[model samples]
Target chain A: AQSVTQLDSQVPVFEEAPVELRCNYSSSVSVYLFWYVQYPNQGLQLLLKYLSGSTLVKGINGFEAEFNKSQTSFHLRKPSVHISDTAEYFCAVSVPTGTASKLTFGTGTRLQVTL
Target chain B: EPEVTQTPSHQVTQMGQEVILRCVPISNHLYFYWYRQILGQKVEFLVSFYNNEISEKSEIFDDQFSVERPDGSNFTLKIRSTKLEDSAMYFCASSEAVRSYEQYFGPGTRLTVT
Candidate 1:
């Protein structure tokens, strides 16, 4: 079984400032990592994912994340943020399987961007 | 681009009432999933379906909860007897069989139990 832990429950950043939302996981085997964003009451939108190869993954809205296997972390970062970027971000992980894979999600980090 | 779609964006029912949420997955996708999120909580997986049957399910998907692909194009989740704790936003998702990790999610159905 896999589990995700997002250390920060909330993060407040000023406009155009850089921010990082930390995420850590525990798994005995290899796993896939992902980041999803939800705005208001809308559905979850995939921001980025790391399946294999590169540890650094880029996503929409200038967001990116680095998968650090040694530390069991996949932290999401953005050089600059906007008011529109304010939303809830979720970090998830799934073990490889032949059939459908199930995800373990973190508690989520609410990014509140202010002027 | 293909996307998952769900019906009855919101529904309200009394306890012990039955409720069914519907979903239409992407045209060529072969995997389907159901997840729910209570207020201020992370999304919880309910079940995953493939080949006309359930492939995996979490403890939350008890006997009262069942999923079916009644038709080639539609998938549904039925709760036999609703409970107050069942009130949440239920999301339907799907992904291509080749890449099951990148699932596309629907807007979700908000189930309100009173």
Candidate 2:
């Protein structure tokens, strides 16, 4: 079984300020980590994923996340944020089964990037 | 550039009535999925389908909930009887193939059981 925990329910930051959203997972086996962002009335968009290889992965919109195995964390970070970056971010985990894996998502963190 | 699409952005139904949600996956995708999120809750997986059959389903997918891929492009989810608890945003998604965990999601249909 896999589960994701997002400690922060809401994060507020001013424009051009850096931000980090924390995520942790619990699993008995290796799992794939993913970060998704949802805008108002929009669907979940894949922001980034950690399948294999490098622990630090860069994603769209100048966002990045580092997979810390020892800590069981995959925290998302951005050097600076814009007002447009205000959205709800989710962390998910799943074990790849050679087919579509059922995802377990976190409660989500609402990023309120204000000017 | 293909994307998943869903119909009936918002629906209002009385309790005990049946409601059907529709989805059209990417033309080339081979995997389809259904997920839902209550107003402020985390998104929960309902079921996953492939090759015209269900591959996996969560416990929430009970006897009252059923899924079908009747046509090449259309996938549908039907709830036998609606309850207030069933009100949520239902999202449809599709992925290309095996190991392609990146599923493209639709705008979602807001089912409101009144």
Candidate 3:
């Protein structure tokens, strides 16, 4: 079975400051990685996804994540953040099972951006 | 941009009562899925539907749970004899294809089994 681990439960940062949300996964086979953000009382919005090719994948809202094969990590990062960036972020891994695919998600990290 | 949509943003139901959740996936998408997120917990997959049948399901999806695409546009999930533990946010998602890996999610229906 595949699983995702988000090391931090919460991360606090000031506006315009850089932020990094850590994520790690364990899977025997190649997997697809993704980051999703959920604002207050809203459904998840896809931030980025890593399917193949480049290790550095850029996503919406100026966010990016690097897929480190050796470390089995796909950490989300932003050079600077805004108050609007405050939300619960989830890291997920999708593994192919026969003809279908399923996503295994992390516990989620709440990003609290302060002024 | 077309996106998945679910009805009944919030539902409060008594335990042991039956509740049905509805979803309208993207018109052209071929795959549909249901996932749930209990308060303060990670999102868990319930089941996946394709070709008018269930392709896969998690252990969390048991006998009491069922899914159907009764029409060309609407998909539904029925929980028989709902339990208190079933309280959570149920999300409906759809993807253009199975391998696309880009499953768009709906706003979700918050089911509160009291």
DockQ (CA atoms), all models: 0.82, 0.84, 0.67
The estimated TM-scores of all candidates read 0.98, 0.99, 0.98
* TM-score of chain B taken alone, every candidate: 0.98, 0.97, 0.97
Candidate 1 per-residue C-alpha lDDT over B1-114 given as tens digits, one digit per residue, 9 for 90 to 100: 777899999999999999999999998999999999999899999999999989999999999999999988999999989999999999999989889888889999999999
lDDT, candidates in the order shown:
0.95, 0.95, 0.93
What TM-score describes the B chain of model 3?
0.97
lDDT at B9, model 2: 95
Residue-level lDDT tens digits of model 3 in B1-114: 898899899999999999999999999988889999999999999999989999999999999999999999999999999999999999999887755578888999999999
Q: Over the full model, what C-alpha lDDT does candidate 2 score relative to the true structure?
A: 0.95
True contacts kept of 3: 0.58
True contacts kept of each: 0.73, 0.73, 0.58
Question: DockQ rank, highest first?
Answer: 2, 1, 3
Q: Could you tell me how far off, in angstroms, the CA of residue B110 lies in candidate 3 after the best superposition?
A: 0.4
Give per-residue CA lDDT, model 2, range B1-114, as digits (tens): 788899999999999999999999999899999999999999999999988899999999999999999989999999988999999999999998855588889999999999
Question: Lowest-lDDT window of 10 residues in candidate 1 chain B?
Answer: B95-104
> Which ten-residue region of model 2 chain B has the weakest summed lDDT?
B95-104
Q: Candidate 2's residue-wise lDDT over A44-105, tens digit each?
A: 99999999999999999999999999999999999999999999999999898888788899
At residue A6, what lDDT does model 2 achieve? 100
